[model samples]
Target: MLRVLSLLLVVQLCVAQQLEWPKQYTAKGQIILPYGDIVEPFTAYVDMSGKGRSRIDYYGGSAIVLNLGDEGQYGAMFKIVYETTQDFANVMTCFAVPGASGAPVTPQGVLPDISMYKYAADYMYNDVMSEIYISNNAEEEKNNNYTLLVRKDNKNPILFRFVGLDRLFGSHYDEYVIEYSDFETTVDATVFDYAKKFTCKGFPGPGLTLAMTENPMFEFVGAGEYEEKHRSYKVDSDFEEFKGHHSRQYDDEGEEAKRKTHFRHNHRYIHSMNRRDLPYKLRVNHLTDLADGEISRMRGYRHTPDSPRDTLYKPSISDVPEYYNWRLRGAVTPVKDQGICGSCWSFGTVGTLEGSQFIKNGMKNLKAFSEQSLMDCSWGYGNNGCDGGESERAYSWIMENGCIPTEESYGGGRYLMQDGFCNVNKSECGAKISMYMNTLPGNVTSLVMAIAERGPISVAIDASHKSFSFYSHGVYYEPACGNGADDLDHQVLAVGYGTLTPGDPDSEYWYIKNSWSTHWGNDGYVLMSRKNNNCGVATDASFAILN
Candidate 1:
């Protein structure tokens, strides 16, 4: 109540004015996601070479390079991925935003970042601001000198609450809060080292692919040989915390030692990349210790490649809103965790059904459908319980096998997180579907239209990239993700679609709701780039029409 009243009081005495910023500078701070979730501490260098080229170095061993060129236009985050267990740890992964330049560059594409120290003197023309408060510290709520400003657009009054009004580029807006500190006007030329950004395997530049060559923590004489190449080093305590975050435990001490070595190499890879400006950002997460084979085991989508395309509905992409999300309309459900199971397809199917019901009516009639029933009972439809399955197949099972039971009806009041016996009453109807249909493969136009008219659509994509497994949020795009039928191995629900920058045609993205629990991603939701079919996201898209 006090926060609201304070905002109201400020508005009453609000003096609308334009905000100013620095043309180029250097600063250090942290990026915060919504609801006060912080990424890691960062040091940013902006406007080097007088070409708007800049970089934000995250403390946890990753950096973002922006405005370098065509490849660096949308910016990219440096990440580490192991192709195979034998592969040495390096920055083999570079998550990038490769697209045509748009009218407004979103935070995802903004270089040096607004938190990096204002890169430009001019601010957003549409932004109208009112003074909120002034503080000695940018982070302090009630202090002495630095000012706080509330910048808003004509539509959303609560668009952005920027701290550090004295320092034009403290932080910005709605979904994220980029905090700034330790300001310095002096620019460092060494900050924009080519090896840090362009050297990434996914970045389109010289020897980008050669980054696969690993600086192994130990020496490898043969394919599986392991020996010390460098002096013995003690494992960092923070690495143990990283392991604990993922609940990783090794069976044998040798394997444990090997993984620790791998973890150290991965850490060194990120730390070295942060020394200079990079086009992308990278960070350690649960999947950092696992190799490609181990990560692939977690992907569960099994749509057959070379199968005939099943085009069911092709709605015209006309008169549609540029941005639409089912969650805004109360159609999409809360993000759920799938635990350690590979039944992601079932969650996608049930979510789509639940959404369709909500869209047809409203949230008053919505119910949490059972994913366990599909895991246990839908095996005859080619769904391997708790293993892997296809979303279209689950839809087929529902079409012929009657209605799906609610989560409560299936168990008591919780999910049966693993494969279980068939306890579902086929005759009972908690959520009934009329039919399930697929849109044209790789067609973003039809997919967007169908989602806008229909409800959440069940979509699949190639989620094998190590970056994808530990995506911390932002517009997730990896040049390493393959775009083919054989590549789509994870099923998720597309609840909505929107652009980070309004009126920017090239900045649109799909709101993919994952079943990997709220602990991962943007609280279990991935804002994947749209239009390019980057990872075969729209290849096997399907949705349910509630009866």
Candidate 2:
């Protein structure tokens, strides 16, 4: 009886030792398959910030990064097979597929749960001995067990290895390993920062759907709750004062001020992520307005001398189906992120080319053309490089140059995010645009028909409102945003259109493809108010011709 009691006491002590584990550390190792192949070598950097917030990144694209917060939890996985380099972060900066689809097989259970194991060990590595443990089912998979090693002193797992038959494949035994090293009690705060670089098309999780403030304007209800919730976020002492200032200005100036107002201009009840930390001037609108001189320079149509103009031939199309998405048609291209560069012109230009080529040549031959070529080379023909640019100028450059290189070939498959000397090698060109047609300014019918017939149409819109910066979803319609041709500042692609209600014409909205990455909106697209040229979306619609 005494011997049995001693064993129980020892087991209790073992579990107690693992109660407080090292939350911030990095583990590096490789996976050895049954065939003795060492594959998917990786280094996982982890940050568990004690508030149920944790981020894990594996060196290779095999691991998916998890970003969780109170606002909206997002998680996605992608394997960047093409980019194999030392910089894992850059590889993660690319878009990831859904976790279910991504690899290294997202197990139902993760490593570090070592309670199921019964044995322990003191393994020697780098001339130092560390105590560890073992488990037959580290991930609770049938025919799977792991050798778990714990820190010599802390009792936290320092090395973990699962050796068992592959339950999922049922073909061979598998070996997974993780060796924790270079332990640190605390990590840099930036380690937990949600990177806008990596993204998924739609919201990984769900909450409130985005909507514009129209007749049924959303009323701010949780004022006290809003103020209390934001107190935790780092802000200046005068944040309350700033809120007060906007509140007074909004209430005092009557309806005119309300019409021309922004997010904080009327309501302070907003997601903390939506708040901008910029100075008042920069925050007034979400974007910088174009100079009058720049507008004048870009307004004129610059067509290729020998190219034929596109004649508008509309089919007497009836509103057939309740809803339509261009992605279903398979012509839409993979959304490209422009990074920090304001070269929306390049993205818009590239999107036009991708869609046109896919529509003309079919899906198998689709290619992602080079935006860098236009960014670096089109400066002489009126593009501003990283500063900003116009789509018309990009089209004109395409017409003159015959074509640009594929993104894979250009710059050796990387976006510089800065201007570089243009590579004018004709052999690198992957696709060519014969001509481009600009639709009548403020013509919704023409833009709709054009998109239905062709594919995505390059457009310029007024994305100056602060709400636009953090727009998630909805038919964004802000009448105060103005409806002038000159209001267009940001260039994007109109991939398709849809209706919220099946047969309601008033429910129509355009599906806008943005360059700000898939995490920004409904998987990198937005539904803007349709039929009225809301936000001046139809002000300048154009598409490429890949003949």
Candidate 3:
């Protein structure tokens, strides 16, 4: 079946060529596809000197000359292909370049290197689309027969097809893909003017893919290869209590009638969080405790203040046994404190919707959903104050009964009972969305990998450190005391992941993008320790797959 399809495709190519550019000829070096607009075209030039021989220059680069022979003996032929209207236009402008003396040269400064002697005849032949072929068949090479096979409708048209005399009798021709995009354009009548802006686009032609040959042009001793050596150790310690020893303090003093002032303070005990909170479960058991005299071997050991957590800790779609297909990824947006008003249910639901919508649309530009709608309409599902509620249940409610617009929505410390219709406009809210789920245990590496492979993930972590702020490339772990563990309760999104070391066994890191505003961490992002799988909060330990 595949072979039959391939043959039919080749036949179709021949028919398309007859429909687009029917006239064909041989040329030296390169060929240009002519478009009516001098602004765009598939163009190439040939360099026939030095050891580089037949180096064709098209777009911004050049391709090597595989076979160049005397004029008559059967010069080598190159095939060009076009697939779209854009592709047709690109080739047309290339053939329009006039003589050296012609004012307002063809393509009017669109192509940089417009040569007069090398560019043969400029005509339009119909095969598949309008195309132009240039060739150098001097009388000296009259016997030299070159066949330039041009195709109009093909999947990969940005390649050059080459057929040599050696394989002309029976051997099959090999295809070469060309990767050149920028060619020089000109305003004044000049052949080699390199000052003008050149509008460049890649050529989608047949056989352009196989023309690339690996070239090793430079050589240097001592600049080659080297082996790196390091030692390892194993340290036995409580991974949960492991914290770096460093501390600084600040003082706030003021009085209504007196001047207020802040003071600088210092301390030795640096409050550190348990490494286990990081995305990758750092195998501390195999690491040497620098704090202690334990000489434990370590593997990967790269560290960043803010990086994505590991994928191993992320929950897969399979994690949710019931909703095996409900896997999702997204971002988290902030919601104002409802004060005494119960609105978190709305925020949570909207947040989840935002993420799901983003995934559905396959776009990074996420739109906020109406939370006010949920607060006013989600009866029996949400509370009425700063109190919390189940986000999943809210989602279920909204999915069943639909939601309204934020413009018609109202809620805060107070609630106004009002009924509004569901407005399809998804831009009336302020909360962002992100994927939510739990990750597998001890799979910190896999979790980081997953997040990187997928988008971001939503997680619930022990943010006991209310004032979680990271600056520069350092994670200043400081706990905030507000609603305590309750206020300590908050949700955020994890955007990306990175590794501390290129090869450290424990070097895996998570590049987490957060929504606590740009003020928190690295512009609202945090690089939690991935080694101990700390980033994957307990709640996100599992996931659901939604195909």
Candidate 4:
């Protein structure tokens, strides 16, 4: 009984020792692993966790000890586990050494070089060691078989290399695998050095063999108090040599200049008024008279406000009209040019009225409306010639005083005086007028849906002169673009929405037809953001239902 108890005590002591935590140590200058060697060692600090017991963690990964020594050096070993049968296929290992102050040294060679070809031979580099290797696992693979050794002097800096596992194999899709094990050999310095080496065995299949040899001799370096040295190396090679295959010159200055130019041009045309002979107030009053009249015609309907400003409403994909098969042929027309005129309001109002007419009359022909008639004739609602106006007001004017053809009542012709009589062909302008009324104060989605279901609807937006230019993206609000909220003067037609791709829940983007020429974005049809503030679209109508 006494002998048995003693033996049990001995066994318990051995187990306890094996499970004990390794001592912490400061890293010395460098650690090295020679070529063709399987194992190397270095020193490192260990931190354990838990209430009573803990585990080692380095760079956020759990660490285990493979070897321990009091002399302050450590050893690590790596082996290839798998290789590919395909030619030119290989695998390789790489090491990431910590720079001074514990930052990682940038990996040296072009990542993913040829050594990554075969499966078994590729597993040679241990990133923790800042070294890599390529080697063959099979004798039949001897043609490409090779081995790499790495070592670091006590004061020397680390280096990197690519060891050919035989000759280069030219192919893609080759495979390789490797495994690495690390251990701490000594304790003293805060600095740790890691090293790795690789050996290759030939191709996979029968006749595969590996040579058995004694482990290579390794030296143990002692730890001592030394001043920390922080040094960095600069590449002597030309930067052009390192340029990626896809690299290109980016002209940031040119891009900025173009953007500025676009903004400037749009700003001037939209806001600035250049009066040739007529007074500024006269021009503005004429445009305002037309705009107010148009808006008054649509005042009978209930105007609803958008509830949630940010939420976007999209029409169901199935309900959207097909592009080629759409039946509202006359509703969609080419964008018109409002040349050097503050008459955007008139153009927008008339264009929308035309679409509405088509929807109400079931007519397939689109009749061009006379903007000059409204600019010159409308007294209370719109501004004068070449001056700004409101679109909704223009519609009200048209409803009250019916519009004639441009031939019968021509515009003051490009900075010229407004002729009271029609100068163009009056027969072409006699299209029947139509109107639609809104039942609720609808948001952008509801307005568009009403158009899609009922017919084209006339809507007002803040079209201050500043906002006349083309905008690629982003929301337009007052104060930011100098367009006041009350500047809701422009009129437009909401024709349809662009197609939505799968996964886009709110794909119902508004397709607004602008009075600006087709040279504008997407052929004068701006894609308005459907997410908020009704995308600046406000709907009001006079005719609730056409008789």
Tens-digit lDDT track for model 1 on 158-243?
A: 12222322222232211233444455556675755544544445533322221222211111111111112121222345467777
What lDDT does candidate 3 reach at residue 391?
Answer: 44
The per-residue C-alpha lDDT of model 3 at residue 53 equals 14
Checking candidate 2 for backbone clashes, the offending pairs are 132-149, 132-150, 133-148, 136-145, 201-523, 202-523, 286-464
Candidate 2 Cα deviation (angstroms), residue 296: 20
Estimate every model's Cα lDDT from 0 to 1: 0.58, 0.53, 0.29, 0.33
Q: Assess every candidate by TM-score.
A: 0.55, 0.47, 0.32, 0.37
- Candidate 2 regions exceeding 4 Å error are 1-269, 272-323
Clashes per model (N, Cα, C within 3 A): 15, 7, 158, 99
Report the error of model 4 at residue 305, Å: 16
- Candidate 4 lDDT, tens digit per residue, 323-354? 22112466755666664455655665566566
Error of 2 at 340 (Å): 2.4
Please give the ranking of all candidate structures by lDDT, highest first, separated by commas: 1, 2, 4, 3
Local error of candidate 2 at 312, Å?
Answer: 6.7
Return the number of clashes found in candidate 4.
Answer: 99
The true-structure Cα RMSD of candidate 2 reads 24.4
**Residue 104 C-alpha lDDT in model 3:** 13
Q: Which model scores highest in lDDT?
A: 1
Per-candidate alpha-carbon RMSD to the true structure = 23.2, 24.4, 28.1, 26.0
> Higher-TM-score candidate among 3 and 4?
4
Error of 3 at 175 (Å): 79
Give the per-residue lDDT digits (tens) of candidate 2, residues 231-319: 22222222344445444333453332223222232222122212212111112222112222322332222223342335343435644
Between candidates 2 and 3, name the one with more favorable lDDT: 2
Candidate 4's error at 78, in angstroms? 36
Evaluate model 1: give its TM-score.
0.55
